[model samples]
Target: MAVNLPLPIPENLTAVAGIELGHAEAGIRKADRKDLLVMKLAPTATVAGVFTKNRFCAAPVQLCKEHLAGLRPGAPIRALVVNTGNANAGTGESGLAKAKETCAALADLLGCAPTQILPFSTGVILEPLPVDRLVAGLPKAISNLKTDNWHNAALSIMTTDTQPKAASSKVTINGQTITLTGISKGAGMIKPNMATMLGFLATDAKVAQPVLDRLVKDVADRSFNCITIDGDTSTNDSFIVIATGTAAVEVNAIDTPEYKALFAAVQALAQALAQMIVRDGEGATKFITVTVEEGRNVEECRKIAYSIAHSPLVKTAFFASDPNLGRILAAIGYAGVDDLDVTQLNLYLDDVWVAKNGGRNPDYQEADGQRVMKQSEITIRVRLGRGDAVSTIWTCDLSHEYVTINADYRS
Candidate 1:
């Protein structure tokens, strides 16, 4: 049995009515269980996605890219096939063929073009996918697709994840309301090159593919791209959004207040789901939020934030709940950003100021710092004393359990 992680569904998903979602127990990796999910989009749905930059990306990532490449401006994807327990990465040409076959199977079931179907997989690496298992599971998943199965769909994507992640939000535009729901899976290998994990956000709102594509990229940058777990990015990381246009109201650009609100709702949903991934990070006990402010630019701030997030010393210190300010400071010093000034730096733990001007604060107390560390969630704020730029990043603590889980993962 796998160790269960805290998987909670985010509120604000009940606003959309036309979108139907569901999952089936395919018994792909485990016997007598459901591990495959099928998502159907209403006819003529528009889709937008971001995929991993890893050269060794999984077969599904390649398949998704091919599907999205064929998408027109207004047409929507027909279906999505996702499975857990085998990444299907690095299996060479056979993996590619399996991915294409999976898409073809889904297309055949939905009576749509193969290029209109997308597939994603996450699990052990380098193993050839049990294509028979997935093929056998397709009919049940398609037959069982429904509107209220978001929870089941969320759980079907889990691999080593201890939790099922979901988020939802609603926005009103042109006197018409739209509902958005999302599900994601990730834990162990979670440093996103293009995307950090497997994410799917869907809405009944009608929007053009161009607008959806732009919005997905913007939101993904601020959410999925801002998180870290083990510092190793997966070959399977990808995020996708689908629009069914069931609401009957069409919007062209994100200029109006209503459109901005819609964008905010989507961004919130994505960020909430992304944070959930980190909170349930494999073997994670504490959640740390790193905020870098006063940098010369957003890129510089992100550099500082990611450096601290991916550092083993910083993560382990978080696990121990030790206020090891030195490790954080050191990480900032080596963040590889241009025009950094260490002399004018300031650091804070939660609301308590710890370091100032490259040294310990005169009023800093070890006991006070320890008090802050006792919480399962913590915030580290850094002021570079340069410009007004800011960036926020999330990560989980490093622990021996994380190593143990991965060391014996294949066994």
Candidate 2:
């Protein structure tokens, strides 16, 4: 079961204008399941994205980057094709060919150049994608393309997710209302540097390509990059933003108030989706948030936060509801901040101040820590009496089910 997360309601997922989605039962790995998705965009839409930083990035990621670089004023990405159940990574040149072939097939059907299409894949890494089945399903996906298919689109890209992750909201900027809808998927092999997740946000706002490009990165850092599942980054991680110029509001610069308003909406939706991944983390029974504050810089704070969030010992302690508070202090000490002053550190679990100035608080009791640890959701606050910087990372406790899931994944 996924911690405290609830299933997404389909009717509540509003569709962004100028984008149509369709899904098909490709049966790439499983029978009678949605394994293919197609997102058709308007000709006026502009696209931007941030991909995984892993050196062994998947073939589709490399192809998507190439297609994005080829964007120009007259030519824009017309469609995006996604497949689940096979990552299309580590097949060397053959994998690259298969990815391109998938795009070419979809492009032919859409009457657009192959370069105008972006392809994405997820699931069993190193295994060759069942491209034949995926290609055969494109017609079915295209035949059903509808603007209100966001719900089905979310379900098509899922792998280990217990439920489809999707959200929608409307923001008014200068009297013009912009609708943003997004979907994401991931349950394990998630970490920073794109977070091993696939996220796509589409808005009915007019945004210049350059500005949209920068906005995706900014939203990703504050959202997806602030989460970790197993401290492992997948090779196919990607977060893309699509702006269809159907709304009256036009944004071409980053310094305007309209830009800030748009950014807030995108960031909020992205964070909600990102946190869902952690909440549904493989074998996760507890959702944990680690916030590091009072650091000399944001980088150091994030480092400390990630260190504690990624500590298996600390996570296991939380899973067992054991008040093993020292594990957290140890994680912060070796967080690569070589000059960090341990004497100035503090730790807290919810409202219980467990440590004061790097030592166990005299007034603290083990029962108080246990009480917080037993909760379904927890927050671990770390204070470094250094400066005024803070960063928070979301994660989930490690459990026996996580090991079993991975061990039997290929079977």
Judged by lDDT, which candidate is best?
2
- The RMSD of every model to the true structure, in order and in angstroms, is 2.4, 0.7
Output the TM-score of candidate 1.
Answer: 0.94
Please write out the lDDT profile of model 1 over residues 1-411, one tens digit for every residue.
Answer: 112334454443353455566577777677766689988877757788898889998988988887788877445577888888888999899999999999888888888888888899888888889988899889988888887778888889987777678877777777777888888888888886654479988888777778888888898998898888888888889898777788766756877665577688889999988888888787888888999999889999999999999999988987898877799999998999756778799999998999989899999998888898878888999999999999999888988889998998877
Among these predictions, the greatest TM-score belongs to 2
Cα displacement (angstroms), candidate 2, residue 406, comes to 0.7
Q: In candidate 2, residue 125 scores what lDDT?
A: 94
TM-score of each: 0.94, 0.99
- Number of residue pairs clashing in candidate 2, backbone atoms closer than 3 angstroms, sequence gap of 3 or more or interchain: 0
Model 2 clash pairs?
none
Q: Which ten residues in a row have the lowest lDDT in candidate 2?
A: 67-76
lDDT of 2 at 39: 98
Model 1, global lDDT? 0.83
